[model samples]
Target: MTSEGTFCLVLHSHLPWLPHHGSWPVGEEWLYQAWAHSYLPVVELLRRFAGEGRRDVLTLGVTPVLAAQLDDPYSLRTFHEWLGHWQLRALHASTLWRGQPVLRELGAAEHRAALHATEDLETQWRHGFSPILRSLVDAATIELIGGPLTHPFQPLLDERIRAFALRSGLDDTGLRIGHRPAGIWAPECGYAPGMEDGYAAAGVERFLVDGPSLRGDTSAARTVGSSDVVCFGRDLEVTYRVWSPKAGYPGHANYRDFHTWAHEVGMKPSRVTGHQVAPPDKAPYEPALAADTLRLHVKDFVDTVVTRLRRLRARNGKEALVVAAYDTELFGHWWHEGPAWLDGILRALPEAGVRVTTLRGALEAGHLGPPVDLPASSWGSGKDWRVWDGEQVADMVEDNAALQRRLLAVRPGPLRDPVLDLAVNEAMLALSSDWAFMVTKDSAADYARRRARVHTERFGAVLRGERPLPLEDRVFGQLDARLL
Candidate 1:
């Protein structure tokens, strides 16, 4: 049977640099959790697909900042230690909760998972993510995407700073993965009218934006502002099936609940029994039940894509493109059954007469639409810059503007100036979009504010020579101030 339009799944993986910072609740803990649950499993799954001779399964974006940490010696050692601790905690849970049958079962399940993850990390991820990612890229199993350093909100960034960050970020990816990707996730799918000029200059041929950014006509990738740079807008209708603030597949009663905590052992032991169910009243998480629910959701998602493509083809008179993008962390980290669901969907799509490919593959197959004069937008609230620039974050916006101005004033030359380069790095770190997004969402708002302010203060201290450059903040080691 002939296939419908192509389905491109783009997973944006990112975390602000966290080493030498706090650990618990919001720092390295955040990175390790995503690493253990999402990165480890997702990459392993891709390797399995590659072993099966799959090519161009999906597009994976790894921000330069996170890439650095994944490959950093400090991060590697710490992550291994973290995994060991995870195993110990799971064992402790199993011992402490043995009196309660339900909690004991959950504890035993967690221990098994933690043990498997530890072995996976010690074997496949021993060196770092670079080797594993490079092998997959070389095998043509996935198209890797790179994004700006620190994952700054580009639409709000100074043009010079934005251009420098994008180029440096691409270069960083090339250094780590041995391939500089032509596609980017565009830091929150944030875009401004002329950002494509910078993208084109940096050799970025394609990028992503929110569905509403392209006015919800995401049936095809559109070239922005006459540049050859293509903007692939997310098909919200398709993506929201798996993830959305209000509700999604993860909320299924059979799936493990992300919020319910087993405080003593630091594990989630409950299923999402009911939305309004108290945490203590939530049912114990049953892996087999979640697996059954995952199968159903996967089938539903495949059907959704089939129906969407048929509708789009009828309307557009062609096999249009349907792009569904999400944060890679959403998989095993936030949604415990996500990786399994992903595996099922990827395998099921082709069987259902749907062509699954990367964004680059879709474009090469002639999925391009007419050029669009894209307005300033982001994938944030309102599909505008409000989340980063609203009255609620006016102070942050102003502070970022001031930092950029100070950075530009330094105007360091092509020759590397240790002080100046470190200053630029600090400035970029402060400009990360995660901080404002967290503040607006009230998720670790205090930590986010502190991180931003600390980086900003360090930027000033470096410029004044009041603070010596620390080895800990050496994320962008090759960052040249001249790039700005």
Candidate 2:
């Protein structure tokens, strides 16, 4: 049977650099948790698909900052240790909470998962994530996407810094992955009108934008402005079916509740029994029930895509493109059953007469549409740049602008100064979009502010030669300060 239209699942995998940083509430702990729950499992699933000869299964964006950490020696050692600790914690949960049968079972499950993850890390991920990711790319199982250093909000970034960051980022990815990607998941999908020129200059063949940025007609990829660079807008109607803040399959009653945790065990043992159900009142999580719910949601999502594609074809008189982009951390991390659900969807889509492919694959399959001049937009609140540049974050926006100026002023001539490079690194870290987004959403706003301020202070101290450049802060070792 003929397929309806192409389905492109773009997963943006990113986390601000966190290796010498703090832990627990929000830091390396964030990285370790996501690494265990999401990255490890997601990559494993992709490897499984590749073993089955699946090619171009999805488009994956790995920010340069996160990639650096994944491949960093410190991160590799620490992550391994963290996995061991995870196993210990799970064992503690089982023994410490023996009185609670549900807790004991959950603890045992977690222990097994931790043990497997530790073994996987010791073997496949021993070197770092680069080798594993490169293997996937080499096998043509996934199309890798690259992004700027530190995941800065490009639309608000100074032109010189933005271009430098983009180029350096692409080069960094090439260094790690054996080739630079032609596509990128623009930081936060934040884009301004003329940014496509920068993308074109950097050799980026395609990028992603919010659905509203293209005026909601995301039937296919569109060339932006006069640049040959194509932009694929997320089909919110399709993407939101699986994940939206207010409602989504992840919030199903039978699924594990992300918020309800056993504080003593440091594990979540409750199901999302009800939306308003207090954490203490929520029912114990049952993996079997969650698996059943996952199967149902996977079927529903496939049906939704089929119906949407049929309607789009009828309206446009052609097989349209449906791009569902999401944070890679959503799988297994935010949604416990997400990895399994992903496996089911990938297997089911092809059987249901749906063509699953990467954005590059879709483009190659002739998914291009008319050119568009997109407005300043993002995949944030109101589909605008407010989340990163809102009133609540006005101070941060101003500080970022000042930091960019300082960085440009101190731009190295031809000589490579380690201090200057470190300064530039600090500046980029300060400009990360995560801090602003966290502040705006109040999701660890204090930590966000502290991190931003610390980076800014470090940038100043390095410039003034007030502090010695630490060997540990050596990320982007290939970064040439003259680029700024």
Candidate 3:
């Protein structure tokens, strides 16, 4: 390698519990879309790279909730059904776009893409995602990282529940992947003053945070709160070049526009022409052009990493680390060209003198620095907790706090109560960071509000010695508190 400096790409993959929920544009559909698009393609690409002997391509953090759903029998069966429906939708689009030449071309491309995805899912992902992910981890092509159960914003959670959630999440990952993870994503990169104690107890060695959380000194990994667990900060200057909400590589003209949809067929038919262009006025998506654009982005990112690492090395007078972190859903799901871009960058970086490693790999490579008294922080809006505990969702914050207290106060008698376990899980689900994020974004505000309320209600009911309402027809009976 031309430089000893390392570049770690941390992909945080997470989604709240969504099975048995609504579909289309949200809920289980969200999981299925990400699965078929992001998860399947990204995994396949990683496997392909691994076959060619690539190692430490990236660190992948798959939250426990998402893992549970992906590994669940129902999710596997239902996802296949969803993929079949998606292929049919493309066929319908082909028919619907019969006359217009451009539309017909777009329909053909989408149809072929859907067919390819379905084939991949049937052949590789037929069983569950764990096997596929486990294979990658085994090959050392990627490091698998775990997160809290349900992906809660950990800063606001009670210490005991927080500790339990983190430990339980790692345990769940161990059960699925055949070994416990030594690191966690820390649920939204949210960190509190004393979180390192829990993380230390949970056996986490390192985690990623936003650059601002490190006070803009993200050139090296730093330990937090006297714990040996190192915290790496995301190089926003590198990550945002591909995926910022306002402008990023995804908004480039050649790529598919995520918003404009062929409603009848449930396909995106337009390219991102210009910011002001209405959906109807947007030009048809051309995969060939998008492929070329993907290459350009891949080269740009590789160059950017090379430049950043060189500068950091010079400034620090030693080998430095630059961590670029992002949501794994960005690939294939959010950005149609994301997986290709990832493939290109990984392939291009090594050839360009930038060594790619996981966060753990960086630490192992001796990128560690001194321990710092880290503040209560998160990677959320304003580099603080506003997106979750701000004025807009104050009620939710209170509700979560109250539920945590109630949950911790519950006595399970002498035996492990399955009902208590179920209720506690529900309460934790309600505290997921996704709901507050959704509410703050106003995209799925109502659903987020309802979900939070439902979980709290379930916890309350269970605590009051009453049975929570069943999903379908089954009824839960009251639990006896005096059984001890």
lDDT of 1 by residue, 99-163 (tens): 98877887888888888988998899888999999999999999999988889999898888888
Taking all chains together, each candidate's TM-score versus the true structure is 0.98, 0.98, 0.95
Between candidates 1 and 2, which one is better according to lDDT?
2
Give the whole-model CA lDDT for all candidates, comma-separated. 0.91, 0.92, 0.82
Query: Candidate 1: lDDT over CA atoms?
Result: 0.91
Candidate 3 lDDT tens digits, 1-484: 4665798988889888888767755788999999988998888898998899888889999998888788777788888888888878888888888997778887887778878888887788777888888999999989999988789898888887787778777877888888689988878789888788888888988887888888878888998876787888888887788876567899899999999998888899999988889998999888888888888888888888888888888888998888888899999899888998888888788788777888778888888888877777788778888999898888888888888877777777776676666676677778889999999889789988987887788777865779754542111122222221
Model 3: what TM-score?
Answer: 0.95
Ranking by TM-score: 2, 1, 3
- In model 3, which residue pairs have backbone atoms overlapping below 3 Å? none
Predicted structure 2, TM vs. truth: 0.98
By the lDDT metric, which is better: model 2 or model 3?
A: 2
Q: How many backbone clashes does candidate 1 have?
A: 0
lDDT of 2: 0.92
Q: Between 1 and 3, whose lDDT is larger?
A: 1
Q: Write the per-residue lDDT of candidate 2 for residues 284-372, one digit (tens) a residue.
A: 89898998888899899999999999999999999988999999999999999999999999999999999999998998899999899
Best by lDDT: 2
